[model samples]
Target chain A: MKLTKEDIQFIDTYLENSDVVFADIRMEIVDHVASDIEDRMSASNTTDFYNVFKDYMVQNKAQLLKDNRQFLKSADMKIWKAFLKGLVSPLTPLIFLTSFFGFYFLYLNFNIETFRLIISYVPLIGLSGFLLTYVVYHKAKNLKRFSVVERLAMPFWVFYQIPNIIFNFSYQAKNLATVLWIVGIVSLVLTLMLVLVCVSIKLFKSYEKQYKTLA
Target chain B: MSNSKLYKGSLTTIILKLLNENDKMYGYEITQRVKELTKGELKITEGALYPALHKLEAEGLLDVEVAKVDNRLRKYYKLTETGTKETVNKLEELAEYIKTMQALVNPKLA
Candidate 1:
């Protein structure tokens, strides 16, 4: 007892009206409800989609919606935890060390003004480039509206302001020690930004692969 | 049947064990399989089942694949390599727990 396209659409519309709006989540729920309805219809040897759907909803809608909310929260938490874990991963020290030496070299070779300009603009440029690439990838893949992708992008957007924050504080350093401290801090920030970019790319690639294969 | 709480704690193990036996399963299929296996003794609600599935997924213990079935897309879940390994450990843990409970609840059976 396969449901008609109209039956499927009816369930989709019902869910959307109930605020289960994310396509990824809605898609799964729609299938679940449709499957449930089909099973009931077959078992009863009747094809009353509306009555079966209504009964299923009466019994299950609240719980389904609750599960959807719980999933969203847990998904957000998992993404943040993964991002934070990536920040302190084994590769992080290497990135930090390289960034430290790189910043130290720039500070030594360039005048303070030039160093400040380079430090400020380099991360900004890098972040901007990453943002652009992320946007273009989503646009090309047509995955812009996925709730999971939006959650994954949240940390990157939050960390995107790190460069400007560092830039603002870079001006306050007066002595060599203070400058050294700033350099170390900037290197740390760079490492964080780099890790954020890597994690985002890894997660996005995994999802892109999943979606592509599924498609 | 009256001891859903007893089963609540074991849902993850149940899901992993099912996926371990079967290659992959969708949400509705998993529910139906459980129902059939239990002979109507245990029923997993959508609220409990999906959150559990998503949690396992977030933990990287499950991987999802979507296929268009009939008129719509259906999401299927399967155990990952880590998940497959974890399934064995979880089953062992569950076995131990059940033994302890049996010994406590029915010494003659133990």
Candidate 2:
């Protein structure tokens, strides 16, 4: 009654075709279905593997897929919330405050027009390019494992860019002369904080380790 | 027997209680264990079980470990420290609710 390699393979293909994308979720479903099939086979009434699987899927597929989607969405939200929690926690305030003050100090010290111009463009351009390149490169490297959150990271970065674009376009040179220091400081703090927060969040590390063996 | 809707609300407490007793369990094992414990009057559907487990894990109440067994990867879930503490609170809450329901349903016993 144990599932053979061919049986397991067939189940794997069936799930993939059914659009169960994440390997972790797929593994759980596969195990559940396989175990259910084995149990039915041992009952001695159901002999056909395909029929058992088909019946199980017919009964459970919608709920299974819906649950998978819900779990992924909730997981993504939880990770972002955790990242925000990390940012606002007492432990990390020093890091963000330090960055904030560091940028403010740089603005006060480096008041040159060219220096202001360069600082203004550097972070906006640099961060946008870095995020784009990271997304493209990571997608290219691990296309199969590019999860919903990973794909969503691109649009999320673009959302960040909307503010940058507005700030850059709306501020005149005279306005910049008046508050370039403020602009530079705010942009630097925001950009560095975003990068730091994104890289430092380890909520998914354990899942990533488990997934390494999967897809 | 309880309504499925009523059972759904207590599913987390039920799961926590099971994990507290057993130390670890996988998806199928959990459903089977629940059925065995309930004597088949209650069945934990595949739909309900996996999402519940994942949600608890996301909430940091549970931890997951994947081990290879019989040539396939099996994901096991167990309670975390927070989950252990939460289980006690949830069980107390459920117990009080059950007592209240009993008094309402069987006034002579009260």
Candidate 3:
């Protein structure tokens, strides 16, 4: 028994009301429930979608929603693991080295005060720009909210505030060694952020591909 | 059949073994397959099944592919290269475990 569009919409509405708000996770659950209801309707020789759905929910809703709550944590773990894996990938060191040398070159050529200001502000500016672009891109593409992709952006949010925290502390490098240390740390942070952005884009594209056929 | 705990430890292996045999399977299909293969003695619930799938996916052992089927999108899980290799290892480990349990449960059979 194939479910009608209205039947699917009912399931979607029910899940949303039940707090299954993330579209990616909700899509999977909707499919699972719809499939189960179809199987029941076929076996029982009944077309009463509501009765079948209600009965199924009575037996399964608690379990399903319980598992749903864990989705965010699962997504968080997956994102962090991906980020860590990205950090250790062979390309990371190359990116780090290249950025390190590039930053160090600028440091040598540019005035020290201007160099420090650029290093401090670049991550903040870059993070804001990335967020703006990400929001607009997703809106333009009409991509659904995915928990994994949302979690992937979390580290950048934390990184975005670091410059402000340092500014508040008014910490300044006093010597070449201190300046070099700051440069190295900034290079590493930039490399990590770049890797995270790459991972985020990869994840977004994967999800986009998964749902591309949807109307 | 009443003790889900007995099967809990082997859930990952069961999933891997199934994916090893079948090219790809979705959540509902995997559960139904388990019930069918076990002659209804083992039923994999959705609560238990999705988490396992997600964990294996996180571990880089399973790859997910989504496609439009019927009126909805179906998320199918398949064994990655690492997952394929790990399935063999898990199956071997499970066999050894069954052997140990068999020896303990029925000494003469050992």
Candidate 4:
């Protein structure tokens, strides 16, 4: 009583289409559904994989996806809150405040054009770095080998791209005053991206260690 | 199957206790084990089981490992050190709750 590769692929496709794109969640659903189907097939007279799988999916898929989404939503909130807690703590907050005021005063008094430009583009740089890392390191290099949790967390990186989209469409920072205003917002976004990356990397490392023992 | 609502509250305790007894178990194996142990009186639905397992892992009460079995990757869950500690507490708490419920429901038995 086991599922074939084709059966697994078919389940994967179904899950992807049904908004179960996160690999971590997808893998669980796959295992649960596949196991149940195998048990059913073994007990029954029929050996048809498709029919058995379809029957189970028709009965249980919606409930399974609903339960998973509910869990992921809460889990995502907890992870975000933990990262936010770190960022808002005494030391980190003081450091960020000092950096912000330092940058603001430098731009305010000296009016350096290059510094202003770089400040204005901090959000764009952060977003680009995220995109580049994801495309090169994550998608290209190790997507095939990534554990389920890693794949699930990939979609959350889209949050970093939001600031990039805002900057692209509405940005008109030609002067230091405009640069100062936009830079603050951009720097905030950049900090958030950094926090997200740190949390993701930490999570990936733990997940990798957990899976490595099985390998 | 028993009432899902009643069983829901105790699901985590049940899972932890099972993992405490066994070395490791995959999703299907866990469900089957529950069924066999309960003699078909309890059924762990896929909807309930997977979400509960994921939540437990997120809470650091369980750890997961994946291996290639029968040409497909099978993810197995085992209790972590913290999870082992938690199981004892949960079981004792559950035992207390059950005793209270028994007293209320069946005074003679209590």
Question: Best candidate, lDDT-wise?
Answer: 3
Q: What are the per-model numbers of colliding residue pairs?
A: 0, 0, 0, 0
Please list all clashing residue pairs in model 1, or write none if there are none: none
Task: Judge candidate 3 at residue A24 and give its lDDT.
Answer: 77
| Residue A97 accuracy (lDDT) in model 3 | 93
Model 4, A1-215: lDDT tens digits are 77788888898788879887666566667777777788899999667999998889788877877866665764565466556655775555554566567667766676456554555566555456545555554555454334333443453456556555646533465665676666566556666666665555565555556445322
Model 3, which residues run further than 4 Å from truth?
Answer: A106-112, A162-170
TM-score of each model, in listed order: 0.85, 0.80, 0.89, 0.74
Each candidate's lDDT (Cα)? 0.81, 0.69, 0.83, 0.70
Docking class of 1: medium
Q: Model 1, range A1-215, lDDT digits (tens) per residue?
A: 99988999999889889988677788878988898889899999998889998899898888888877976777687677677779778999998899889988998888888888988875675476467657866777665345565676666566666766877877876788878888887888778777877777776776666666432
Q: What is the iRMS for every candidate structure?
A: 2.3, 2.0, 1.4, 3.5
**TM-scores, chain B, all models:** 0.96, 0.95, 0.96, 0.95
What are the per-residue Cα lDDT tens digits for candidate 2 across A68-176? Answer: 6765765565555555555565545565466556655665676546544644554454356445545554464352442433534543465456545645643443554
Clashing pairs in 4: none
What's model 3's overall lDDT? Answer: 0.83
Q: Which ranges of candidate 1 are over 4 A from the true structure?
A: A81-91, A109-130, A161-168, A213-215, B1-3
Indicate the fraction of true inter-chain contacts that candidate 1 also forms. Answer: 0.69
Cα error, candidate 3, residue A187 (Å): 1.4
TM-score of chain A of 1: 0.80
Better candidate by lDDT, 2 or 3: 3
